[model samples]
Target: MPDNMALIEERLKLYMINLWSRSYYMGTLGNMSKEVVERYIANQRTTKSNADHLSKENSALRH
Candidate 1:
């Protein structure tokens, strides 16, 4: 029973994280896409050169 409770708690934490991340990311997808596309446009923004790169953008939560 204790083990099951622990598993449930862990899963709940994961679920909440996933839910919050999805909501946060999806909400600004429209605006994000605009800013995001600029990166791909090449020499159009601050990060010159079009190249694939892993990025983690957490703009202090717009909403």
Candidate 2:
């Protein structure tokens, strides 16, 4: 089984690939600016933090 970090990285890469492909098809390939990349990074960080919090809460409840 893959570790948590590895799994996250893999999923992130897949998501980026899908996003880029869609953008390319929509003719927004050149419009991908730094702000967009930063937003994506921030979104990923928020998602990971939320997932971690949920996992901790679930474990605590279980115990």
Candidate 3:
């Protein structure tokens, strides 16, 4: 049903946000996480004009 689909969509969005928040938090935790640093560097090297959504969320959480 439409209601069920809507509920599923909402849950999926929440799950994605949860995952992004965790990833971002882990990335900011410390300098010893080499993998996180490499991933961040790789993301920075990309030519995308818009800011990454998860990065934005991570920054907002910091303040």
Best by TM-score: 2
The candidate 2 region of ten consecutive residues with least summed lDDT is 21-30
For this target, which candidate reaches the highest lDDT against the unseen true structure? Answer: 2
What are the lDDT figures for the candidates, one per model?
Answer: 0.56, 0.79, 0.73
What is the descending TM-score order? 2, 3, 1
**Per-prediction TM-score to the true structure, in the order listed:** 0.34, 0.51, 0.35
* Global fold similarity of model 1 (TM-score): 0.34
**Can you write out model 1's per-residue Cα lDDT over 1-63, one digit (the tens) per residue?**
999999999999999887764223445446556656555444444353222221323333433
State in Å the error of residue 63, model 3.
24
Name the weakest run of 10 consecutive residues (lDDT summed) in model 1.
Answer: 49-58
lDDT value, residue 5 of candidate 1: 100
Candidate closer to the true structure by lDDT (higher is better), 2 or 3: 2
Q: Which stretches of candidate 3 lie over 4 Å from their true place?
A: 22-63
Q: Which whole-number lDDT from 0 to 100 does residue 47 have in model 3?
A: 36
